[model samples]
Target: MDQKMFCYQCEQTAGCAGCTGNAGVCGKKADTAHLQDELTGALIGLARAADGNHPTGTTHRAMIEGLFTTVTNVSFDNEALQRQIRIVHQEKEALIPRCGSCESRCGRNEDYDMRMLWTDQEDVRSLKSLILFGLRGMAAYAYHALVLGYMDEEVNQFFYQGLFAVGEDWSMEELLPVVLKTGEINLKCMALLDEANTKTYGVPKPTVVPLTVEKGPFIVISGHDLKDLKLLLEQTKDKGINIYTHGEMLPAHAYPELKAYPHLKGNFGTAWQNQQKEFADLPAPVLFTTNCLMPPKESYADRVFTTEVVAYPGILHIGEDKDFTPVIKKALALGGFREDTVFRGINGGTQVTTGFGHGTILSVADQVVEAVKSGAIRHFFLVAGCDGARPGRNYYTEFVKQAPPDTVILTLACGKYRFHDLDLGCIKGLPRLMDMGQCNDAYSAIRVAAALSEAFGCEVNDLPLSMVLSWYEQKAVCILLTLLHLGIKNIRLGPTLPAFISENVLNYLVENYGIAPITTPEADLKQLLGEA
Candidate 1:
C-alpha cells in the first residue's frame, strides 16, 4: 500500500502546511517520522515509569538523548530512530516491571500516543508543547555541557519535571505554569552551558571578524560551541590550514583567546538554513559542531565533518579527544579558491562583530544604566535567534527597521543577519545594534537582565526592556522557557507559534505571562511602547 507523509515539525514547513503526503518539508520520509513518533511515545512511557521511581543518572542521560534525537532537522535514519525507541522501551520496561501475580493485566504501563497531546485543546496543547519543545531545546544544551563533564543538578531535575508534565492530563491551569516553568528551568540549563563553555574557553571579548577568505586551504566551523572551535584552532595551527566561522560560530572571533590565533581566517557563509546552497561546491571543508545540520548534498557532503553531538551519515565524526585531523586533511586536498574570496552577508556587509558575552555587557553596565536613567536609551529590543527561509520571516527585518531610534538592540544567533549589518548609529560609544553571540549566548542576555535589575533595585520585568524574539529550533525553545522562568512578562514571539502548541496551552500563556503572538511590526511596537 502506498502511504503519504505528514509532518509539521518545523516553523517553515511547506505552506506553513505540515508535510502530509510522503515526506516532511525537511525531507524526512513518512517512515522516519513514524519511527520518531514511536520514539517519542516510548519516551513518555519512560518518563511515566520514572514518575515515582526517580530517574537515575543513566535514565536521565537516556531521557535527554532520546528527546534530543527527535528534534526537527536532527535525525533522519529509521534505524537510528527505532534503536532509540527500543532503548527507551528497554529503559521503561526495566524501570517499571509488569504486574506480578495479578489476575488481570491492565495497560497502565503502556506507552502513550503522542497524538493525544497533539489533538488536545489548543491551550493545553500549547503549554505541553512548551514543556516538550523547551525540553528538547534544553536537551541539546545539556548534551553539549554533558560532553564537557559539567552538569547542574537543578537543570537535570527540571528535565524530568518537564517531561513528566508532557504525559500529564492536566488542564490549562495546571500545565500553563509548567509551561512557564519550562522557561525558568531552561535558564539554569543555559547558565550551566555558559559556565561549561566560558570555563573551557575563557570568557568571550569583543573583536571584529573579516569576511575576506584567504587563499590556500581553510576549514569553516559552524554551530554554537566556542570550545570546539578553540580546539580546532589549536589543532590546525601551523598545519597549513586556516579556519573560518559560519553561522553562530562567527562570535568565536570576538573572544580574546580565540581571536589571538593567527590562522583563524574569516567567516565563510550565513545562517544554518542556507547551508545547502552556501556549502555547495565550496573549495574548503566545513565542520558542524552541533545542530542545524541539513542532509548534506553530494556536491559538498564530502567536505563536511561533524564533531561532538552532531552526526551525519558518511560524514567524518570527531570524537571525545576532539581531534580535527580529518577536516584539516580535507581542507588541504580542496586547496580552496586560488585568490582571496570576498563574501557578503544577506545585507551585503563585508564583516560582522561578535563576542559581546555577559562579561562585555556587564563591563558596560554603568554606561547602559546611566543612559537609561538619563533618557539616552529609551528602550532595549533584543532581536535575535535562528533564521529560516520562511517567507514571512521578513517580519524581523521590518521590525528591526521600524524600532524607534532611542532603542538599543542586542541580538544573538543567526537571525541577526536579517539586519545586523545595518548601521543603526551608536548610543554612548556603543553600537546601536550589538551581537551577543550565538543562540547559546542567550545566557549573556540573562546575565545582562539580572545585572540591570540589580542596578535599578527592581525586578527585570519592571525595567524598560522588552523581548522581541524569533525562533527556529530547539535551542530557541529552551531560551524562551528560560525567559518564562524568570517571570518576565509581555514577550512578543513570532513569526508563528509552534505547531506543537495547542490552543488551550496558548491561552494559559496569554492569561498568565501575557505572552502573545507577533502581529505586524507597527502593532507589536506600539503595544510594546504602550501606545496600544
Candidate 2:
C-alpha cells in the first residue's frame, strides 16, 4: 500500500520481487495497475454475490470480461477499467438485488481489497495467486470460445468458484487444491476452445507464411482472437488491403478459415514485445484484438486500433459491430510500402511454417512411432509459451538450436518467433521443429503426448518428451497449472520463476513435481538428454 502500486504477476516484474514504482516493465503505469486491481476486486464481489445463486449467461460473461481485462498487458485505459468495474458491480447487484439495503449487513459480498491478497502471508498469497492468475488466463481462452458461440457450463461455473476462493479467509491447505483445480478446470477450458476453433475453422493444416510486406496497403493484427481476424478478413476481402498476422496472431496463417483469404497475405513482424519498434513509422494500421499490447509510442500511436477487451487510452477501438472501416481507410491512405518490401523474422528468415496441430500430428502417428522405434527420432521437446522482451529469452532460441537433430521440437505461441525461421530440417520426413498452432493449441501438445503414451504403453511423463516453457503473462500461468494437474513433471521454466511463488510453495513444486527454473541451455539440454 505504501508503494505507488503493486504488480508482480509478470515475469519481467521489477527486481523479481514486485513492480511498485510509477510503471511496470511492461509500460503499464501505477494508476492503470491500481485500476486493474480495483476491477479485480469488483469481480471478486460479483463472484461472491453469485455464491448461492444460479448465475445467468450475463453474469458468466461479466466474470470472463472483467478477469480478462486485468490480464497483464490487456487493458491500460483507466476509463476502460472504470467502465468494466461498473459492469461488474451492476452484475453483482443483479445477482443479489437487496444486498445493498441489508439492515444488519455483513460484508460477505462486498468488493474485496486486493491489497489484502497482495499483503497476505506469503504462502497463502502464493496459493491464492496461482488460483487467481490461473483463472485470469483461463478466462481469456473462455472469452475466445464464447465469441465463437461455444459454452461449457463447468468452465463458466469455475470462474465464479475460483474468484470466490480468492476472496476467502482460508488456510494454505484449503487453497492448494483450488490452485491445482484451477489447472484441472483449465484443461477443460482449453479443450473447449480447441473444439470451438477447429470446428469453426476446419482443423489447421501445415502452411508456410511469408514475412514480406507486399506492395499494397496492409493491416497488421496482433493478439490471440481468431474471431476478430476472421471478421477482419471477411471485411477486407478484395478491398485492396492485405491482412498480415503479428505476434500471437501468427498462428492464424495456419487455420483454414483464415488462410483461405488470399488478401490475408502473411505475417508482418515478430512477437508482441517487438511491436513498438516494428510499428513505428509503419505505413499501415495495427489492430490489437487481445493482450500483449505495450503502451504505444507517439510515432505509431495514431495508427494503433484496439478491439474486444484490449484498450489503450486514446486508441481507436472497434467495438462489437466488428467494423474495420477505420483500419481499412488508414491502410489505404498510408499506401503501404510503394514496392514489395521484404522483412525477416528475428532469425532473418523470410518465411515460417505452422499448423502441425494434433489432427495433423496424430494423422502421422504411425510414421512418428516408427521413427522413434528405429532410432530416427531420439527425443521430443515442447518449447512453448509466451514470448517477452527479456534478454534471458535468448535461452529459448539457443535451446531450440542446440536440440539434437534426432529430436523433434514442438512449439506454439509467440515464443516460436525467437527461432521460427530456423531450418531444423526433418526427422524421418516429419519436420524436426513442428509448430502446433497457437498457445491455445497446447491441447494439441497434450493430445499428442497422450497418444504417444498410449502407443508406447507408458505414462506421458515417462515418454521422451520434456517441457521447456517460457511465460510472460496470465495465460501461461493457467497452461502451466494444467500441465501440473496432469501430473507431468520435470518442466524447466524461465526466464525467471514467478515472483508470486513463495519460497515454500516453490519448494513444494520442486520437491514433488521437479519443477525447476531454467539454467544455461547447455546444462539443461545435457541433463534432459541424460548426457549430464
Candidate 3:
C-alpha cells in the first residue's frame, strides 16, 4: 500500500515471499521498481487499446521492449523506464486517439494498476502471475528474434492477447488455460528465435573454448545478443583488440559465423552472479548486451557499459547506433592482461565446450539412439536455468557430481557454469556433459527430447530422462510453463519454488504434473533413477 513497492518475480526475493521495502533483492531501488510497475501498467493499457484496433510495427515493438525492460536485472535505470512508459502511452494514444474522452476509458488514473493483481485473491493472483511472468519471459525471446529481422505474427499477436487478459477480470478457470497457452505460444516464439539465430549465424558446432583471456587489449561481452557480438567482432576485426564472451554470451564461440572471427576469442568469466568479483580490477571494458546485469560495483563500475535493454544508472550505454567506438576505446585504453591469463571454471577446469544445438545433436541422432539402446547411457539430467547468488544453489553442482557415471548431464544457460567444467567423461561417443547453448537454446533441448522420444516410440516423459532444473527468474517461468504445456511430468524444480505461486497453484502443479521441489542430490538422483 505504501510507495516503497512490492515484487516477488525472482527466486531470491525478500523472505522468499516478496521484496517490500526500499529495494529488491536484485538491488532494484524502490523508485525503479515503481517505474517498472508503471511500465507494465502502461503496457496493459496499450494492449487494451490495440485489442480491437489495427496496430503498427511500432506498437508491437514497444510492447516487446516494454515487457523485456521489466525483466529482473535487465533495466535498473528509472530514466530509461520512464522513457519506455512514455512510448507505451504514446502507442496507446495512437491506437485510440482521444480515448481520454471515450466512455470506456480505464479507471485507476489511466492504466491498470499492477497492485490490483498483486492484491487479488490468492488463486487469481497466482494464475495471473503465471501468465504475466511467462509473457515477460516470452518477450525476451521475441525481442531476440525481432533483432534478427525475424517476426512471427502469431507470436506478436499473443503479446497483445496475454497482456489484455492480465488486465481483465478473468476467473481462475478462464485464466488457467491462458497460462498454459503462454507456454504454447512461447514454444513458437523460441522456435522463431531458433530459426533466426541458425539462419543468420549458421548452425552451431561443438567448440571447446578456453577459460583464458588472451594477452593484449581485450573486451568482455556479456548477456545474450549474438547480433551485437557479430557487430563487435566485425568492428574489432582488424583492430589490435580481442573480444571474449562472458555469461550467456559464451555460446557465441560455437556459431559458425561468429566463430569465424579470429578476434572473437575465448570466454572470460563464469556466470553473471560472480561478475562483481570476477571483473574486479579488470583490465578491459565489459559490454552488457542484455540481462543478468547486476548493479555494477564501483571497483569495476567504470568498465561496465550497457547496450539494448540492459541499463543501470551511471552506466555508459551504447545507443541505437550499435556502435562499439566507446567500448573499443575503453578496451584499448585499459590495455588488457599484459600476458595470457587462464581462468578456470568453478570446478577448476580450464576449458568448456558448447554449441550442441538441435541441429548438431540431431545430426547424430542415430549415434545417440544407438548409444541409448546399447545401454551405454542411463538417465539424462537437464540441470539448466539462470544462475543466481542465493544460498543452496550448490544443489546443481552436487547433483551433477553425484549423477552416476552411466548417466548423462545436459546443461544450458548460465546454470551450466556450476558443473560444466567437471570431466563427466563420455558414454559411448557422446560427451556425458553437453552444453546446449543459452536459455533460449532450450529449444534445442526440446528438439532433442522430441527426436529421442520419436526414436524410442514413447512420450518424452516415458524416456530415460529427468529434468532437474534450477530457476532464478521469469525466463525460467515461461520455460517451465512450456514443459507443463507439453504435459511432461515429474519435473524437479529448485532451489526454491517461485514465490509468486500460491499454495493452491503449487498443489495443482504437484498433483497434475508431479512437480516437486528438489531435495538433496543423492535422494533426488536415487528417485529419478528409480532406485529410491
Each model's C-alpha lDDT?
A: 0.79, 0.91, 0.91
Regions more than 4 Å wrong, model 2:
1-3, 100-107
Q: Please give each candidate's TM-score.
A: 0.91, 0.98, 0.98
lDDT (tens digit, per residue) of candidate 3 on 64-152: 99999999889999899999999998888888776453333343225889989889999999999999999999999999999999999
lDDT value, candidate 3, whole model: 0.91
Candidate 3: count of backbone clashes, pairs at least 3 residues apart or interchain = 0
Task: Give the worst 10-residue stretch by lDDT in candidate 1.
Answer: 99-108
lDDT (Cα) of model 2? 0.91
Q: Compared with the true structure, what per-residue lDDT tens digits does model 2 show for residues 65-134?
A: 9999999899989999999999999888887788454221234788899999999999999999999999
Runs with alpha carbons beyond 4 Å of true place in candidate 1: 1-6, 86-110, 121-123, 314-323, 530-532
For every model shown, the clashing-pair count is 22, 0, 0
Q: How much does candidate 3 score in TM-score?
A: 0.98
Query: Which residue pairs come into collision in candidate 3?
Result: none
Q: What's the lDDT for residue 55 in model 2?
A: 85
